[model samples]
Target chain A: MSSSANHAVSYPRFLVRLLSVATDGGLQFYAWMTFLTAIALVGANAWAHQVADGMVLTHMTDHVSWGLYIANFTFGVGLAAGGVMMVIPAYLYDDHAMHDVVIFGEILAIAAIVVCIGFVGVDIGRPDRIWHMIPGVGRFNWPMSMLTWDVLVLNGYLVLNLHIVGYLLYHRFTGRKPNKRWYMPFVMASIVWAISIHTVTAFLYAGLGGRPFWNSALLAPRFLASAFVSGPAFIVLLLLAMRWLSDLKIGAGPIRTLVSILRVTTVVNLFMLASEVFVEFYTGGSHTAAAQYLFFGLEGHNDLVPWMWTSIVFNVVAAGIFLTRKGIEDNRFLVAACVLTFMGVWIEKGMGLIIPGFIPSTLHEIVEYAPSLVEWKVTAGIWALGGLVLTVGVKCGVAVLSGHERLVKG
Target chain B: MSDSADGVSRRTLLKAAGATLGAAAFAQALAPLASWAEGMSSEDFLATHYKELDAEGLKTALKRIEEDTKKKTGVDVHVTADAPIPGVKFGYALNLSICIGCRKCAEACHEENNHDRKTNNSYIRVFEMDKGSIDFAKGTVDYAHPVPQPDKFYMPVQCQQCDNAPCVSVCPVEATWKEADGIVVVDYDWCIGCRYCEAACPYHARRFNWQAPEVPAKEINPDQGYLSNRLRPQGVMEKCHFCLHRTRKGKLPACLEACPTGARVFGNLLDPDSEIRWVLANKRVFVLKEELGTKPSFFYFFDE
Candidate 1:
């Protein structure tokens, strides 16, 4: 027999052979889940302590009222926003090469949403009373409260997208083609929903007149641009990991296409960021004080400068990596580039977005803020929880697709 | 038995039973309203956000207020109807030059409105600017230490209660609204703890209760105004109300009374002889951030 023919037969039996390997992998997965749960429990306990003691337990003082929780929330939002780039190809362009990988994107979205929600819970002093936000019973609907809509859209989108993705995977495992007609509508809805979630979140910051750094017309667009670049970079990095670990081949053609898209999106994001900087400095208005504090460090609070400069450098480097042939083609280089891009976007979207908004605050006071250890550990727990969710989701998806388990076990 | 006496007794018994039933039903219907009315004074009775109470509830509340006012202040204060401006709705004004920066306003505000003592957060920020710099652009309101620096003059800026208030416009849920009497009030229960209003207010007038306010019952200022100083739920936004309970009832704001310089003035702009109107017409009054077109009711002036 020809070597190619032999490989084809063996590949079909790959899952059967890998079933033994999965047993060991399952043990690892359980261990990881247990570790994550323990961390989450500890974090939750600490959070309860914070609630009992008030925000005094947090290192966050009036000057730096918003700290790690907000930063993590912003980072999670950015990560969630990144799902759009992955969706665009599968839904809009109908790229078949991306079909297997699309589930991973949805998994990431689910994980990101959990982290986002978790961060919000930790940030609020009275998280137990969060149900008061429900309409009709407590002040059900507040058109003036962007938070109300954000809750609705974010949770709604997360569920809808997750359901649609789950349904597709179920059918794929059952040896039945998914009813494309049903998924088509969800796909369309997801596109619009994705845009809405990020836009509304941006408005949450941009609408604030007190925080000059956040109060800009460019904010919403800037958010979208950053999401487009960062989201794709994350997906690409995951695809590389999958390529090494599994037999799933995300073709070079798709990687190149995604890289090209990232190249354009990163440019747009950079442009928007530059324009914002120019307007702040050039206008020479009362608002310039906030921008000065963010970039140059007003007074002695220069804590953010090193971090901000690093973000700028990493962003530039990531953009450079996408533009170059060597960076995008080589697997190792691609991983490094994507990792840098992810971290860069995290800093830019997290600290760069939130801290700057409050510095040279409305009162023209430079308040220095840093997150405490408890805050950091809680954030880490939330991140681990997100990863755990994504891992389980991807594992379930892969299992079903490979048809390792019988569709009709009962 | 005397037949006439028996008949009269029967009628009286029937009337007494009917009156008892009527009173019981009235009490049952007014249960929530009555509970709310327990500690509130008459001045505060009429000045609630109005949106909070239904018609029957409002009537009962108003009656309760009248009763409370007579008991507390020992004065007969009439609560009158003042229609909100057609399109203008509500606005606020403050005089920077007249402000002593003593923070009596802030303290009075804290006391009048049950606020968290640890944070000591209040809506009003008294900026002490340099004496020579009449320009607000050169003003430095945030100082690390004690106030009234040698070269400084004080400006107390609270909720501009802007005609075009950004905070009101940006609220995703309609938890906050502008009332007819030129006051911006937030529904404590309705606020989702988003801090959007805090972000939106140019004056930084709004504060979010990160934790439940820790005010002692003794310090709770039993004479509560529902909209101005009622115990707030954690996560909601709050701000200064210009002492709605007092000002609406023809009494002076606590801050105005406490001011050593008598620099503060309080009155209705509609009232021709009202001191606020007089200050606006006679003095070289200027509103903060007039360029932003927030159309603040708070005015600043210097006595020549």
Candidate 2:
């Protein structure tokens, strides 16, 4: 054992050291951070412009009131929920190799939630008045509004993950064995909370009976299934990157386990998509107007057709790759599958799902929406910020877990 | 000078330059927020929800709004927070048989509600549909040269003001609610403008203010109800309240008066002898999207 194990530092000292370790990094780290920060600044500048000018800068009319921002927000909720895929295998099944790197999953969840909240903040017309949703001071229409439930679940999931991750990391930093009582319950809660976050998000759209496109019973399950695919796909990419760049010896065990998870989830996602499409097309009605606009063209407005088809193609190809022998053995094929599935799910769950709901609007007006440049910048900025958070967190977390950084003195 | 002294001076110079650059960038980044802040007063930001405000507080809020309106549009608009009349349950009905799709009511609504002139925004959308069809897919709102076109029947849609309003339930903030008078209203100051209500309305009744409404000073309607047709802030939801400012005070709605064919009917639903009740009892009356079970106070009838 290392000599640092004998040093039992106070909680305050542990935090101070954690901050110091997180901030101090190599030249490559600085370069990556600088790139992310620059992009984030660009996004912020774009958002400022959006706010100063009206929402008119966005291509969203009163017809398609929601567009790219809501799309990103939906995808983000799934990504955040996807993070718990690691936690379940690690804690529930007690897979030793998976447990060793579960912190990365939790860290990803944190970053995702930050991205989710950022998208929501920018999406609202008055970010300044967000405080109105506060429970006591501002009226919160809870138990009624699905949005209120969503707010509760997303924040609750964030807190649960934060506690579990914080408690474990702090203990590991101080060279102490983490008590089960401190974090075990929260980990369990987070697993359920993860499911709730995405379900509630799906329900936010689903509950609107007026929008026949989203008022589906299958929406929540589809969200979870797709979430499992994207979540593990993301973690697999992270594991491969870490193995390549760092001296940390992540065995092939975690990657294999994640790939297997992705195998089931990816196919299930495609199956659900097919089922939805079959139901929409075979039983065509006025309600199928939005779906028709999405898949085919309704009234010659086929803006989303290419996007939807591309998403399906990417998802199918990736699913095919995952079922192959080289998907497990060859690192390049593994990376390719992960990238394809990640992007596939992003499109399928993001713009493909959200934009179509509003195309043939409630009154059957065929207004279309495309993201404005300002929206794209803001989205890029939020993602870059997520990237920065993940990088710094993984760096600090790996340093601690690998025994490179520990408490030197009490 | 010593090498250490020279290093200190160079370091200080770089630090000063960095600070200057940061300050300038920060100011530039916040320029939008600064300009946005200029439009909203601190009082407006800290204003209470309409229901939470006491009578005294409401008086102050009305005064503040009047002053804000004067400052923005140079119009001395009279804004009232008219409470619903006792034992009154407002109901609206349209005579579809005689309706010509003249769009005069829509125009009246646009002018009376002080809507943004650029979008020609209004609470009413008159759909010109085939005489035998109610399929919204076949309906068109963009007809250019139209007034009771041949074989086309006009159906005007507005907020149903449902007993179980989807819009009210879906609001994360109780910025909107069903009042005692059965008129669903929105506290314009309290809405965060997330547009959830817009998505929830089946009739496509709710309108979102994309930017500050622009009405020329002389054209601005001086008579306004606080929740009815008063100017709404940019980035909030607004919809028809059955012209409560006029309807509650024993005056007819601007739209009703503007309908040259007497195709519109309005009165208290609770009143046994009211015109709306008479239409409901005698005419073949139905509510739009009845399958949704919104139980709208608004009705449609045909005198076949």
Q: What is the lDDT of candidate 2?
A: 0.88
Candidate 2 Cα RMSD (Å):
3.5
DockQ of every candidate structure: 0.14, 0.65
Q: What TM-score does the A-chain of candidate 1 achieve?
A: 0.90
lDDT of 1 by residue, A1-410 (tens): 68578446644554443342233243556577567656765566566556655555677644455777887787787678677677788768888877777778878888889989999877875444465566664454556556776888889889877888767865664455778787878877887888888888888887765666887889888888888877888888777766766565567766776788888988788888899888889898677876677678776778888888888888888888878887776877778778887888888888878877777656665667877777876787788778767766666666655554434443
Write candidate 1's Cα lDDT for B1-304 as tens digits: 2349887577557546745764564355335434334443444322333566777666765566545545544544344333343433222345555565788877777776767887787766777777886554556655666665667888887777777777777665555777776788776545555555665676767777766677654565656565667666554678877777766665777777777777777766676766677778888878766766677777778876
For residues A1-410, what per-residue lDDT tens digits would candidate 2 score against the true structure?
44354434356676776665665555787678668777887888888877767777788888999989899999999999999999898889999999878889999999999999998888888777898999998999999999999898988888888888788877887777888999888988999999999999999999888889999999999999999999999999998899887878899898899999988999999999999999999998898898999889899999999999998999999999999999999988989999999999999899999998888989899988889898898899999989988887888778778877676533
Which model scores highest in lDDT?
Answer: 2
- Candidate 2: residue pairs that collide: none
Model 2 ranges with Cα > 4 A deviation: A1-9, B1-27
Worst 10 residues of 1 chain B by lDDT: B82-91
